[model samples]
Target: MMMKAVLVDDEPLALGFLKRQLEKVSSIQVLETFTYFDSSSNISVIKETDIVFMDIEMPERNGFQLAEQLLELNPGLEIIFVTAFNQYAVQAFEVHALDYILKPVQTERLKKTVKRAEERINAKQEAISEKPTKLCINVSGELMFHLTNKDPEIVTWRTLRARELFLYLLHNRDRSINKDVLTELLWAEVDQEKAYAQLYTTIYHIRKTLSNYRDYLTLKSVQGGYKLILSNTIIDLYVWEKKLKNLSTLEGQTIPIAEELMAIYKGGYLQEYGYVWAEAERVRLEQQWVEAAQQLAAYYHDQGNFSSAERWYRELCNKHPDDEISNYQLFKLYALTGKNKLAEKQYQIFKKALEDIGTGVPHTMEKWYMNWKQGIARKTSM
Candidate 1:
């Protein structure tokens, strides 16, 4: 497997040496090099990088801090710290670095590190290949389905109409769709006879495409409409909504289950499809997500658990940056947790985001911040 590698060192000489050594490893591809860590330049590329050859000692931030940031962007990223000092050996291992090699780098030692990285990459690929195949209908992002076995191939449709028809049926799987209505909606400009013929052709291709999973699923024409006979299909939207419905019955204790349900929602329903029919369900699912996140954040904050509250709010903000409420709550939680710098940063970002949308900070938010500021001042005076 070709591994994407990044080299980072303040010393240009060390970087050059390491880059040359890495070039000898046929498996490693040096995608980029950085002498310093900056969020804008580093985080974007580092998120997609597999391995990083980092220098333990550096100006501004040490290798450990850079590793921490990289791991935050991608937890699966393997870091190998290269430093001349032995004092940082224990600290290097503490961060779960892939390997630590002493500078004045020996070829044998570097090769050992590369071997370990290969083993890790191979193991991950094997684990993925071992997962049981399922017909996964992903409505949270692009409307697509794929078998999750072997190469994990995506099921492609013959046409856009065929894909949309499949998505519409899946979205409304609880009931069968009327054949006539579907034809009119999908092919409104075409003649009724031509539209019906086209619809049937699309259905034929869809069935042919999903022929492998025929034992577990089938398309059936019943009464005046078609229904998907999915005895063993995994629809993400259905599963997510079902889990959310169960959360209400948990009687006030809904933390663990709520979190699990919320995490299943990768994005809005059929978000990339941009179909008008999907908007209602998409909006409904998104609202459910927002409500669940708000309740969880509020529950933790009210219990005086600022750390957990901050985490949930920050997650919400990351997913929905335009969510002013989540941003505001996160800002307050940061202050309560004695993260004044983070609180100020969150406030500034929130202010700028609102301004970009042609609005100023909400008066209520301003009032809350003023009150908090006054409280902080009183405490500092004492």
Candidate 2:
């Protein structure tokens, strides 16, 4: 059967735009739309609806409230968030929403996401959901609960277990966790089948709680495992990764876009969370941070801000003493500021450091020494 959909929005144009887009999706059919709240009678139009494309801010009865009542009427209804963005990302992650779309939705993004939704619908039609009735994903430092039932209000982080489970998925947001692994970590060795059942129970309870914001978070099953799908616009950590990739191409003497990028680096991509792959990302970002610092130092040095330039270059050298460029920059910055002795000392240190690491100091350092000698000869003649 084709996936049936209902669009609930307070704006007429927004509803129209979605209806037209769904027309192209091939698999999704719009059952109805509500630009304004009417009667409970409206629910009848979508009695067989598979998914609700819901907007959070609506007239009279808000979408959240409306969704609650509608779910009360039919507990099996699925939801997808369509918000212009109201700090919804975290809540979305916690609630286990299927997917979310932002305002002015791009056609390509919408089409691709709808295709995935269709896949989910087909999979559900065939898969044995005997595993768990609900899915609860921790949104890092918070609990986002979802289940078949519908509740409108948001969830808060209260217990240690809530925090633990939520942070686990948030840290591993990109990767799926195996049920067997979760069972081992959560319940330890217990009876095999019993532990599996207990694991399902935890996920079910978490899901049941998260069902409140079902439109925002989506925990999907695939290949004998499950994965937490997150929105890039909602995740600043992802934004940083994008900026860092482009930053390497920036060579010299431009505005500090890299610095602006670095400024937005908020605590290392869900810093408090931990997972097996988290350290690899941490190391990656740390290296990027160091690289940005080096670039900013060079930019400032060229701008004649000797103090700021030296400050950054010194940090790069101190943190990564073996970096040849950082050492050379330090020496150059010192020389420019009329600290010849300091410059000579840094060059000496660079040579010794490189020798200790079994590599020759690059020819660039030798030029600094040649210039120093030339200047001394000129001074003696004067």
Candidate 3:
């Protein structure tokens, strides 16, 4: 495997030297070089590379901080610290650095590092290959299924009615859906005999498609109805709700689980399908996300960790921009954290957002802003 690599060093000479040395390794393909860590540049580079050779002393960001952010952007990214200081070797390894090399890197040492990188990359691939293939159904935004093996299976319907029928049964999985209800929902415009025939043909195609996936799925005909059953399958909605339930009952230091829960919510439930039956569940899951985000934000803010609180609040706004209460809370956090510019910017955006929705700003918000300004003035005066 040809590993795509990036070099990040503030010193031009050091960056050049590393680039030249890396070129000696036939397995490594240099994708990009950066003198400083700019979020925009680094993130773009990260999307195309597997390894980042980072320097310890950059102007604004040190190697450790850059490494953390890089991993957050691409968790599988391998980081190798190339620096002059041997003192940082312990710290670099602690952060899961693949290898640490000091200034004036030896060609042999560099060769060994390249070999280790190849080994680590191969091991990761082998581990992924050994894992069981998961069946993931996204009933949140798109009606789709993905095998953990990475190839997505697109269900082609013999007729549009066939697709809708399968979705109906999936929506009411485990419960037998009555034939009359199915007919009314999917075939109301057709004649009785013809409608029944259509349903039968649709069910046949569904069964045929599912036949090969018997280990993962099943469709059964019950007395006067049909039922869809899933085995070893993961539905995002079910997982999100389960995580929400678990996280809601717990208090304090729930960041780890909160992060997991946030990842599970792909988007509004079955949004692409736009079936009337999905709206209620969609609304319910959205509320769960809101509560989870709010709780995490409050937890971080209460802990005097403004940075983490800001991150969660920003995510909340992305999901629910109309949440004025959250916007106000975020504004307060920004002001308290001494981000006066961001606080003011948030207020303007919030005000305009409310006006666009025809609600205008509330009296409570006006009063709160006045009090906040007064407090700021008092601090400034003192």
TM-score (all chains, Cα) for each model? 0.55, 0.44, 0.57
User: Lowest summed lDDT over 10 consecutive residues: which window, candidate 2?
Assistant: 135-144
Off by over 4 Å in 3: 1-134, 148-161, 248-253, 370-382
Q: 101-148 in candidate 1: lDDT tens per residue?
A: 998889888888999999997887786687545777777786656566
> Which one wins by lDDT: 2 or 3?
3
Q: How would the candidate models be sorted by lDDT, starting from the highest?
A: 3, 1, 2
Candidate 3: give the clashing pairs: 140-270
For 279-350, candidate 2 gives per-residue lDDT tens digits of: 686667668778788878877877778897888888777767778888887876786678888887777777
Q: Give every collision pair in model 1.
A: none
| Per-structure clash totals for the candidates | 0, 14, 1
Give per-model CA RMSD.
26.0, 16.9, 24.9
